[model samples]
Structures are given as C-alpha cells and as structure tokens.
Target chain A: MRFTLADSRLLRESVNIISELVTEVTFKVSKSGIDLLAIDPANVAMVDFKLTPAAFTEFETEKDMDLSVNLENLKAILKRSKPEDTIIVSLDKDKNRLTIDLTGSGKRTFNLSLIDYDREQQKLPNLKFNAKITVPASKLDDAIADMGIVSDSVALIASNTNFTMKAEGNLSDAKVDFPACDDTVISLGKEEEVMAKYAIEYLAKMARGSKLADEVSLSFANDYPLRVEYNVQGKLHLGFVLAPRVSND
Target chain B: MRFTLADSRLLRESVNIISELVTEVTFKVSKSGIDLLAIDPANVAMVDFKLTPAAFTEFETEKDMDLSVNLENLKAILKRSKPEDTIIVSLDKDKNRLTIDLTGSGKRTFNLSLIDYDREQQKLPNLKFNAKITVPASKLDDAIADMGIVSDSVALIASNTNFTMKAEGNLSDAKVDFPACDDTVISLGKEEEVMAKYAIEYLAKMARGSKLADEVSLSFANDYPLRVEYNVQGKLHLGFVLAPRVSND
Candidate 1:
C-alpha cells in the first residue's frame, strides 16, 4: 500500500494524540475503510479510529492489511519526517518489517518490526451520555493545564448551563468554569448532568492535536471512560477513550 | 507620564517573563529611552530591560516618568487582559495607583497600587567574555530540558570549535553539543574558550521568554553570572544576568 499526503506532519500530529492514552494501535485497512483500535489496560481507555478512502489525501492499496505497532516508536519515526515530506508505507514481503519512506526536501526511511499486539478487542457498550459539548481547544487546553498543576486526575462536571474542571492538591486549589453560553463554548447540549474523572496527564496529551480544530466533541458518563473525538482536516479522525480514575474521596 | 499599546499581550508576556525572574520592576523613563532594572536578593540574578519609543508598537509620552511597581501584581492583572485588548497605563495624582485601562471587546479598569521595591541598579561590569555565540532558543530549551531531568545545575562549555551543555547525576547523564560550524549555529563570534557551571533552574527560566527571539546571545567568563540578552522585535531588548551557583564538588 502507498499513500501520499501533502505533509507528513498531519499524520505525526494524529499519532502524537493517540499515543497518550493508547500504547499499541492496530490498524485494519481494506478497500472500504481503515479502522484503528486500542485500549489503555489500567484506565481501560480505548480509541476507535476510522477513516474512509474518501478521507485520504491519496491512497493506493491492492490488498487488505492488518498491522499493530508501538505507537511510541511510530511517533518517533514520524516526527523525524518533515511536514513537507511525502510519506510512503509498505509491508516488506516476508512481511517482517514495515518500511516507511519519507521524501521531501530530503529522503529518509524507517523500518520497524511488527509484533503480536493483538488483544481481545472488547465491545464497548452503548451508553447514554447526558452531556455533549464542542469547546474551543485553546480554552480547554488552559483549563486542563491549570488543573494538571494540582492533580494527576481532574473531574469534569457538565450540565446544561456550564462546564467545570476542578482539582485540589498541595500545589494548587483551582477550578475553571466556563458557561455553556460563553464564547469559548462552541456548542453545549445536555439531556442531564454528567461527571467523570480522568487523568489530566492523558487529557492534556490528547488536546495537543486538537488545537487546529475549532472545537472538540466530548462524551462522558459517570465512572466510565470519557470519549473525545475531533476531525483534523477531512482526512483525519482522532479520538480517545480514557477510563475514569476511581476518585479517592 | 502615559503610554498606550496596540495589544496588551506583549506587555503581559514581557511582564510575565520579568516577574518570573524578579519580584519587582522599576522603569526609569527619560527623553532618551526607558531603562528597566530588577534585582533578585542573594544576588542570584538580575534583569536589565531597555526600550525606546520606537520599541512601542505606538508611543506617546510628554515628560519623563520614573515609576516602580510590584511586578508580581502587575503580571497577575495583565494576565487577565485579553490578548487583543488595548492597554492604557497612566500615573495617578497620588503617585500610588497606576490606572490601567484595558479596552477592546469590553472596558475594564484596574488600579494597581505601587510598592516600595527599591534596589541599587548597579552598572554591571563589562566582563571580558572568553566566548560568545548566538544559538537558537529551541536548541537551548531542548538541552536545558534534558539537563533538568538529572540535576539542578548545568555546566556549559563554549569555544571556537564547539558549544556543549552537560548535566550529570545518578538518574542519567545528559549532554547536547553543537559544533561551531553546525548548521544550527546562527552565528559564532568568540575570542577565547569559556566554560562555567550555573544553575539550570535559572537558565530554564531565562530561556522561557526567549521563544520570541530567533537566537539569544550568551556571554560568559570564569565563575561569574551568565549574561543572556535577546533583542526582541528589533527594538525592545531584554537582558538577564544570573549569578553562578557554587556547587559542592
């Protein structure tokens, strides 16, 4: 399979986001679409990544392929590729190595040995989320940053009227509240109140890639992993599902 | 007696940088230019800021003004001002309250009470720097970040041939070396070799504000405070002289 993007930076950014919560990513590519899945064991956070052929800037595939690789290693190699680079990926027959070609102002190649990264993909339950909101990434970033200074985990409370992130710790006792009607809030919809706590460390990582998106879509259920999804360009869909940290109090 | 800025963000950022290094800032404005000087007790560090009317995106001042303010409070208030907000600062009759009018999307006024933050503004000696070089901020940031992981101090060695930053400890040893002729070197003008050990914490703090400059000029002599200067916007110049820490060998 071969694909060409306007820039490799786009793909690098998406990988940077997914690496935060998910360590091993399995991508199944077919004629119809590409599907990616992964989960964080302790947090039980998962990501369901999907992209259609139409979303690809360029796609050329002759057969189906399923591959799982360390997202960290993939990120490191991708980061070496400049944004202006054209990227090409192909499976080395014997298929032991995954060869990635980055050609732009310079030529570079990286080969990573694939491993048995497959795990029993658990079926995520369909649950009703009481709140849904699209908030500017920057504002969310600030709130997350502020909360991160105080606590490893942050509680997100969402109602029809407002969104709040709160953390209490020795370093700081802070709360960031944004009204649903505030300019920072792109959209806020709710059927009821929803609250979940997740590791602020991971949330901050996921938010990094969403900066270009006007807003991020968040779905939360009490005690369950939070779902974050956003589109980067029409071609990329980056999502994260982080398991709620059991609150001490 | 008064001045206006096209945007408050610049002032906020500048004040933030100064406050991070020193507690107070005094601006001695004259017909020739404005001189800003700050000193940290224990003589660990000091900042010397110089700006002329041409430095302001816009400038209007009739008489000389000498004012000292609690930079900590000023930074806190400036942080609340929107980036695009127009900031108007004027001296009040009581000479205690500095009226700050921030108007753009909305009008908000702040009365900042001045403080008696007095320190002798010493004319720093013109030390014979054995070495000097203009290195990109990002490169220095990367090195300092790595060094920070291991120790509180970093040893810098600069010569006509190379520039290196190293930190050694039980956790790990980190070093970033850039050959004098390396492509990353923006410029190299040095007379002799210079090497000194200084606190990494202060270097990191000083480098934080340097994102605005393409390169920062560093001058050093044996066992003296490291002098860091960044020419911002071709007009506003910020300088920091940090006393070297004597670490137990």
Candidate 2:
C-alpha cells in the first residue's frame, strides 16, 4: 500500500486524537478508505476513525490489509511536521515496518517497527441517540477543559431550548451554558431534556478533536454513552464513544 | 510597600527564571527598586534580580523592607496574567499576605500566604572577566536548547575571532558557532581564549531569563563561574551566576 497526502493534518491530527485513548491500533485499509476501531485498555472509551482516499493526493493498494502500529512512535514523527510539509506513507513487508516520509523544504523519513497483534478485531458498540447538537469545536473543547479545572466529571445537559455543561468541586464550580438561539450554537437538539455525566478526563481527551475541525457534533441521551464526532467533510472522520459515569443525582 | 506595573512581563518572567533555581527568596524593597538575590539550595547557581521603579507606573515605599515569600505561590498567580492585564501588588502586613490584583477585562485578586524565612543574606561573588558578549536572546537560548539535546553539559568557547557552544553525546553532537563579524553578535569579546563547561540543566534554567529582553549578555573566563544577564535598562535587571563543571578538557 502507498499513499501521499498534500498535508499531514488528516493523518497527524487523527493520530493525536486516537493516541490519547489507545497506544496500539489496527488500521484496516481498502480501496474505500482506512478505518480504525479501538477500545482503550480500561475499556471506558472507544475511537472510531476513517480516512478516505480523498484525504490523500494519491492512494493505492493491492487489495486489503490490516496493519497494527504503535501510535507513540508515529506521534513522535508527526510532531516534527510543520504546516508546510506533505506526508507520504508506505510499507516494508520484509521488515514489517511502516515507512513514513515528510516532504517539504527537506525530505525526512522514519521507519516504524510494526508490532504483531493478532487479537480479534474490535467491534463498535451499537448505540442510539435521541439528541444531536453541532457547535463550534472550541465551544465544546473549552467547556470540557474549563470543567476539568473544577471537578473530575462534567454533567452534560441538552434540552429543546439550551445545552449546558456544568461541574462542581469542593470549593469551585464552573458552567458553560448556551441557549438554542445563541450565535455560537449552529444547531441545538430538541429532545425535551437529556442529561448524562461523563468523566472529564476522557471528555477532554476526546475534545482535542477540535484541532481537526471547526465544529464538533455531539449525540447523546439521558444516562447514555455520548458520541462525539469531528469530520472534515470529504477528507476524514474522527469519532469517539465515551461511557457515561453513573451518578446518584 | 506598594507598586503597580504596566504589565506582568517584568515580574512574571523574573519569577519564572528565579523559581527554577530557588523555591523561596527574599525581596528587598526600597525607594530605589525591588531587589532579589538568592542561591539555589544545591549551591550550583545564584539569581540576582532587580525590578526598578521605572518598571512600575506607580511605586511607593516609605522604608526599606525585606519580605520572604514562596516563589511557587507567586508564580501560580503570575501564570494567570494576560497580556492586556495590569498587575498591582501590595503587602498586607497584618496578615503577612501578598495581595496581587490583575486589572483588564475584569479585576481578579489573589492573596498568597507568606511564610517566615530568615536565612542570612547572600552576597554575590566578585569576579573580573576578560570576555563579554551580548547576542540576541534567541541566538543563545536556541543554541543552549540544541546542546541540551546531545549532552548533560555544554562547553562554551570564546576567542578574539569567534565564539562557540558545543555538546557531544555518545552518538550525536551539536555546535553553534559565530564569528566576531556575525550580525547576531551585538558585541563579541576580544579575548585570547576563555572557555568553560556548565551543567546544561542549570544553564537552561538561566537561559529562560532571555524572556525579559531581546538580548542576553554573557561574561566568563577560563575555568570560572559564568554570569548571564538579561537587562531591560531602566526597567529591570535579571542575572544568574552558574558554577562551571569540573571538566578534564
């Protein structure tokens, strides 16, 4: 398999978002696109990622392949990428190495050793949602980070007229509230009232997807797992499923 | 004692640099200026700092006062200062608390608890140097960081012709060299030969003082202590003295 991207964002940002949850993941690539489904070690969060052929300037494959690679090594190399660099990817079957090249003013290549993980493929849990809200990515990311300053968990609430993110600590409390008509709210869900509590640490990690897109789409229900998705239209889609925290209130 | 600065850079950057060497330091405040002279517990380095009345838009001190405060707590409050914020500092003598107010979009105040520390005053050692070089702060800071990547210590070499910073690791080596004619060198010393080696970690801490000014001044001699100074004339003076490493070379 070989692929060349005009830029590294589709690849770099995806790795950043996924690596926060899992260290190693299998990339199933075919003519359609590259897909990754991974559940973190503690099984509290799962990442669903897709990079279509459109994300790259050029893409080719023999048929289909499954490659399990360490995200840490890949992230280190990606960290070297400047905004001007383009990325090219290939595989060395004999050495079981994933070869990556960043091309710009200079050419830099890295050979990452591939690990053998013959574990069964992960299947995403089937989840349904009753409410969906799409808001600027910073709105959600900043709110999650703000809540982290006050408590370990954040309560997410959505109603026909508003959405609220609230957290309370022993000595401090923080809240981010937006009415349906607020200019920052592109779309507000009308599900009467839906509420769920999620671990702020995981939510904050998942919210980093904001770096990949201008807006984030969130879908959740009362006491149900939340699905956060970041999509750059024809290029890539990065989604996360976070299990809700059981709350007495 | 009471003082208000137009911005926090003079205070913030000084605290950041000094805190890396000492957790606590006494600030000697007088009509002239506020001065701090501290040696790290390890005795490997000393920070000599001064924030003159020119740095503050308002300054008032009836008598000389020596106040000891935890640098860590002061640093935490400084971290919250924004570029548009003006910092006002005053002492609550009865409560032994340092009250700092940040005024900009809104007003925020932090009263940090003070601890009683009565360490004897430290006097800076007097040393004459045959070499003195003033270069752009980044030219020196970036070189120090580059050297840090290769070794635990960096060797500084200077002659009438050129100056060099070099480091060697088991497999890699890095060097930054500049001749007397280099434009980055505001003034290169004309010394036959003056060389010294210092712990890179301590040097790195002292290099952070560069944040206070565009240029950093260096003075040293063969096998002698190194003095690094960052001065925004009329505003503040932040200097560090780092003991040289015992190198066979």
Candidate 3:
C-alpha cells in the first residue's frame, strides 16, 4: 500500500490529535482510503479517523491491510514535512516497516518498524444525543482554552437559543457564551437544557481537530458521552467521543 | 524608579534572554534606565543587559535603586504583554513588591515580591579579543541551532576573510561559513586566524538575543571566553560571555 498527499497538513493534523489520546493505533487501509478507530488506554475517550481518496493526490493499495504503528513515531516523522513538501507513505512488507518520504527542496525518508496487532479496534457506539450544536471549530477551541485557564473540568450547556462553556477554579472562573444569532454559531438545537461536564484535557486535545476543519459539530446529552466531529467535506473526518467527568451533575 | 515603554518588547525580549541563563538578577534603575549583570548558577556564562531611557516613553526616578527579582517571575508577568499594550513597571517599596501594569484593551496588574540582595553584581570581564566578526543575528542563530543538532559543543573560527561555526558528532557534523563579502556580514576583522570551542547550550541561549537585535558581534581568542553581543541602537543592549569548553582545542 502506498499514498501521497500534496499537502500533509490533514494527515499531520489528524494524526497529532489522535496521538494525544492513544500512543498506538492501527490504520486500516483499503482502496477507499484509510480508517482507524481506537480507544484511549484510560478508556475515558475514543477516536475515529478517516481519510478518503480525495485527500490524497495518489493512493494505491492491492488489498485491505492493517498497519499498526506507534503514533508518536509517525507523528515525529510527519512533523518534518514542510509546507512545500509532498508526503508519501508506503508499507515495506519485506522489513515489516513503514516508510515516510518528504519530497520537495530535499527528499528525506524515515522508516519506522511496525508494531504487532492483537487488540480489536473499538466499535462504534450508538449514542442518542439530546442536543447538537454546530459552530466554528476555532470558537470551540477558544472556549476550551478559556476554560483550561481556570479549571481541569468544563461544563457545556446547550439549549435552543445558546451554548455556554464554563469552568470554575478556587479563585477564578471563565465562561464563553455563543448565542444562536451569533454569526459563528452555525446551528443549535436541544430537546431541553442539557448540561454535561468533561475533562478539559481531553477537550483540549480533541479541539486540535480545528486545524483540519473550520466547522465542528458537538453532540451531547445530560451526563453522557459527548461527540465532537470535524469534517473536511469528503476529504477526511476526525472525531472524538469523551466520557463525562460527572454523573447527572 | 518608574518607567513606561510604549511597547514592552525591549523589556520582554532582553529579560527573556537573560532569564534563560540566570534565574535571579538585580536591575539597577536610575535616570539612565536599567542595567543588569548576572552570572548563571553554573557560572559557565554571564549575562549583561541594559535598557537606556530612549527605550521608554515615560521615565522618572529620584534616586538610583537596585531591584532584585526572580527572572522567572518577572518573565511570566512580561509574557502577558501584548503588542498594543503599554507596560509600566513601578516599585512598591512599602509592600516590598514590584508592580507591572499592562494597559490596552484591558488593564491587568501583577505584583511580584522582591528578593533580598546582599551579593555584589558580577564585574565585567576585561579581555582583548584577537578577532571579531559581526553578522546577521538570524544567521548566527541558525548556525548555533544547526550545531546543536550534531553535538553539545561548537567551535568558532574567525579570520580576516571569513567566519565559520562547526560542530561534530560521532557520525554527523555540521558547519556554517560566513564570508566577509556576504550581505549579512556587517563587519569582520582579525589579526590572525582564531578558533575556540564553547558549550552549545550557552551559545543557544545567547543567540536568543537576536530577538532584540538583528545584528550580532562575536569576539573570542584561542581557548578564551566568547562574547556575543546584540545592541538595538540607543534602546538596549543584551550580551553573554561564555567560557571555553576546552583549552586550546
């Protein structure tokens, strides 16, 4: 299997976000593109990532393949890709390794040994969300950052007309409000006022998906796992499902 | 003493560079502005910094004062300064604290407790250099960074015609050459060829002075301490003197 991306930003961005939650993952590659589903070691969150053929200038694979890898190693190599460089990834079956080539002003190639795969990929959870909010990913990132400044856990409250993220500390607190009428608020809906608390650390890591897509959809329910999704049209999709920090808070 | 800089960049940049070398320092403030001379805990390097009255918009002081502070604390406060903000530093003698005021879109004040000081400031070293080479600070910074990738020590070579910085590892080595005719070589002079080695860690920290000034002057002799200096006209000066890593290498 081999693939080349004219711009490695989507690969870099998505991999970076996922690597923050799990150190190792298996990317199931086929003719359609690549897909990966993995749960964090702590079982506090799960990540779902997919890249379609449209994201790559050239993609070729003979058959379905599971390329298990240490994400940190792949992320470190991908970080070396310059804006003008085209990134190529290929499987070296003879050596049981994966090779990354950055081609442009200079061609630098790095080979990373593949890891053994014994665990099953996480299955998709059928979640029934009571509320869904769509807004600019940057807005969500900013809210998470603001909450991080005050506390380790943040409360997300969504209603028919507005969304609010709030965090409190021993001496300080921060809040970000997004009214449905705001230009950046693409959409908002809720069966009732739904509020849930999530660890800011996970939200901060998941918010990094903003680099791949401008708009993000947030789906949640009262004291239930929250799903945050960022999609770049048909090119790629990166999403995370995070367990709430509290129960019926 | 109290002073306000239209842009806090000079203070922020110089202090940040100095903080990397030493954790604690004493700033001598008077009508002339501020002066600081401190030696790192390892005593492998010394940092000398100065900010003339020309760098500040409003300067006022009735008497000279020695303000001893933790560089890390001061750096944390100054890091909050925005480009559009004016930074005002004032001494709160009654409370034995220093107040930093950042005024712009919002007003924020941070008070840092002053440290007790009984030790004398480091005296400037007096040594005549056999050679001196001046080049763009960015070029010098890049050289130092490249050398850092190969080894923990770097050698500096200077002659009447060109300057070179080289570093060698067990398997890899890197060198940067700057000819006298190079556009960025502001000046170069030497009675004879001279070379000296210094710890790259110190050189990397000193190269950060480039943030305050684009041009840097390097002076050293065989097995002698190296002086890296950056000056922003009448605004400020930040420099470091690093001891040789090996004698006559």
Candidate 4:
C-alpha cells in the first residue's frame, strides 16, 4: 500500500484528527478516491470522510487496508515528523506490523504491531441533516471556546441570516453570534435551519481535531447525532459523529 | 511616553510571563532606557528586568513615566493583540488609569485603574557562577522535559565536557541524562562545574516562560535562589529568582 501527499503536514494533520476518536483506522481506497469512516461505540455518531485525487500529493494504492492500532502511540511517533517530510505508510500482514516512514530533511521510521480490532457492525442510520454550513475553522474554534466559558453543553443554531452558539452555565453566560449582517464570508443558504445541543467536552475535542483540518462540514438534525467531517490531506478523510446532549428540562 | 517592539508577540509574551508571578507591574521608563523591578511577597523571589533604547522598535520619551497597573489585566488585553499590531500604551493620570491600545487589523484598548501593591525589598546578590553554557532553547527544553519524566526535582550539573540533568525520586530508581551530547553550538567557555537541585515544577514554568525569549541567563549558587533573566521584545527584561527546595533527608 502506498500513499503520497505533497505536504506531509496535511496527511499528518488528518491522521491527527481521526486518531483522536478511534484507536484503529480503516482506509478504503479505490478509483472513486479514498474514503474513511470512524464511529465510536453506541452508534450515536459516525464520521464519513472523503478526499479526491486532487487533494492527494500522491495516491498509488489499489487495495484497502483496515489497520487498527493504538492511536496515542502513533501520535507520539508522528510528533517527531517535520512538515516537509514525505510520509510513507506500509503494513506487513505476515509480521502483523505497521510501519510509518518519514522521509525528508532526515529519515525516521516507526514500526508497531497491529491488533485485531473488530470493526463495529452497528448500522449507522441514513442521516437527514436539516442544516449544513461551511464555516471557517477559526470561527468554529472561537465559538467552541466561548461555549466552554459558559456551560458543559452548547446549543448551536444555523440560520440563513446568522449562526449562533449559546451556553448557559451556573455563574457565567456566553454566546457567540455570527451575523451575516457584515461579514460576507459566512453564509447560511436555504434549508439550513438546524438547531441541536451537544456535549461541550466532545465538541471541544472535535474542535481540536478540526483545527488541523481546513474546514469542518457540520451535519445535524434536531436531537440527532451530529456528524462532523474533515477532508484531510489529498488522499484521506477523517470524520467524527457525536451523540447529542439530552436535556432534563 | 512611547515604546515600540519589533514583534508585538514578544510584548504579549513578556506580559504573559510577568503576570504569572506578579499581579501588578511597575515599568519605570527613564531617558537612558527602561528598567522594571518587581518583587513578590515572602521576599523569596524578585524580577529585575532592563532594556536599552537600541533594542526598542521605537522609543520616544523625553521624560520618564512611573506607570503601575494590574499585570494580569494588562496581560489579558495584550493577549488579544495581533503580532503586527502597533501597541500604544499611555497614562491617563487625571482618570487614574492606564490604557493599552493595540492597532493592527483592528483597534482595541483596555483601561485599568492603578492600584497600590506592596512589594518586598529584595537585595540581589552578586554571585559568580562556576558554570555557564549558552545552550539552545530547544536543547534546554528537551532536557527539562526528560528530567521531569523521572522526578519532581532535577539537579543540573554543567562542566566543560557536558551539560547534564539528573533526577532521583522517592523510588529506588533514578535517571541522569544529557539531552545534547557534544554540540559546537553550545559554548562552555569557562571550565566550571556547578550542581544545584531545583523543583521540576518551577523549572518547567521557567522553561515555558523562556519560550517567549530567545535564551535565558541562568544564575545560581549552591543552596541559594536560581535566577533566570530574558529580554522580551527588547522592551521588557523579565527576571525570575526561585528559592531552592530543601531536602528532607
């Protein structure tokens, strides 16, 4: 299996995001471009990520590799990679080992044994998102931070005129409002009215993951699992699905 | 009163570090340059910071200004400043407040009232360091991180041959390692050896503070306070003197 990326930083960034939610990642590579799907237990959320050949620095894999390994260990090894480095990933089925080679300025390779991770067979419902918006990564990050200042859960609403995140905590109150009244960048197209509440902790983790990716594609339906997708690198996609926060009152 | 920095980030960084130890900061600017001295209560630590006009991006002040305000509040405002922002700090003596205006992509200012803060009178000692090495920031950062992996306190020993950090924990095991073996970039001009144990927690804080500045001047005498001095944006020379932890055994 061989994958090439122009900027090794992009691939590393995508890997960084998906690795956060799942320890083991499954890569489905074919002519239609590469696809990645990751889901945590409970099936309340799932991330479906995709990347076209244009985004890949290089893509030369004919077969698929559903490799699973400890994410924290991989992250530690990846931390040493330089931005200009060319990353080469290879798996030896006979040795049950995954090798990551970083080639650039200096050469470094990390080899780790792969574990038999049972890909969950749970069926993910065909999600019907009422709202979808392509907002900048920094805006979402700032909104999430303001949410953290207020409460453990944040209610997000995306409308035609504005996008708002509101949190009510015990002592402090915080709300991030992005009105289309001024900035021409953020726009809410038709059929974009969706309101949902999610655990601020999970959203925060997702935000951290999103920071490395260019822009996050948010999909949500009222009280349903929210889907966040990251178009990582040119050949990879990382996605996260999080359960909505249930309110008592 | 006016002072400018090559990088606004450096100014923001210096304020971030000074705010951690001292709540209020008194910057006494003179015709010669700028000298800032702050001493925390308990008389255990003091910061003596100085900067000359040549290093300043812009220095236009015929007279001196003894401006004192809450360092944390000032830091909070500086945090919002952009790296390219031209920070303008002024005194509104009639209003009894200090205003910091950051003008870059946008304009923002924070006005904080002056407060009376009692500072300890600390007499800095002139001690000759037996060991001195101008090591890279990355090398020092790595050494501190490695030592922290084993124990809470690390004893630094610098000699002509090597710069070593050794730590012994409550457990039977210990670690002694030098992050950099033999680098020509690291200068050991004086054939000297000095060993002093400092709490890893404080060392880590100092290391973090050192990140804002290029290199820190470390001064120490056995059983005495360890001093770290670094210039920030050539406008602030922040200093830190930490007391040594006494060994119970």
Q: What is the C-alpha RMSD of each candidate to the true structure, in Å?
A: 11.4, 9.0, 9.3, 10.5
Instruction: Report the interface RMSD that candidate 1 achieves against the true structure, in angstroms.
Output: 8.8
| DockQ of candidate model 3 | 0.04
Candidates' TM-scores? 0.54, 0.54, 0.54, 0.51
Best by lDDT: 3
Query: Which has the higher lDDT value, candidate number 2 or candidate number 4?
Result: 2
Tens digit of per-residue lDDT, candidate 1, span B25-88: 6788776567887776657888888766665555656777767777766775577667777877
Residue A50, candidate 4: Cα error in Å is 3.5
The sequence of per-residue lDDT tens digits that candidate 1 reaches over residues A140-231 is: 77667656655678888887777777765542234666666656452334446677788887788777855546678777767766878777
Q: State the DockQ of every prediction.
A: 0.05, 0.04, 0.04, 0.04
Worst 10 contiguous positions by lDDT, candidate 4 chain A: A180-189
Model 4: what TM-score?
A: 0.51
lDDT of 4 by residue, B97-199 (tens): 6655556543344455676655554456665655555555555667778778778887766665666678876664345444344331223435456567788
The ten-residue window of minimal lDDT in model 2 chain A covers A182-191
Q: Which stretches of candidate 2 lie over 4 Å from their true place?
A: A1-249, B182-191
Residue-level lDDT of model 4, residues A1-249, one tens digit each, is 656655666555656766756666665566566566767554445655576666656666666556666766777777778877777776666898877788997878889787777766544567767766566666677567656654689887888776677776543344556655433134344555767899887787777655566576677767767777665555456667788876663
lDDT of 2 by residue, A114-199 (tens): 88887776888889887788877876876676566557998888887777887765433455665666443534345578889999
**TM per candidate, chain B:** 0.90, 0.94, 0.95, 0.82
What does candidate 3 score on TM? 0.54
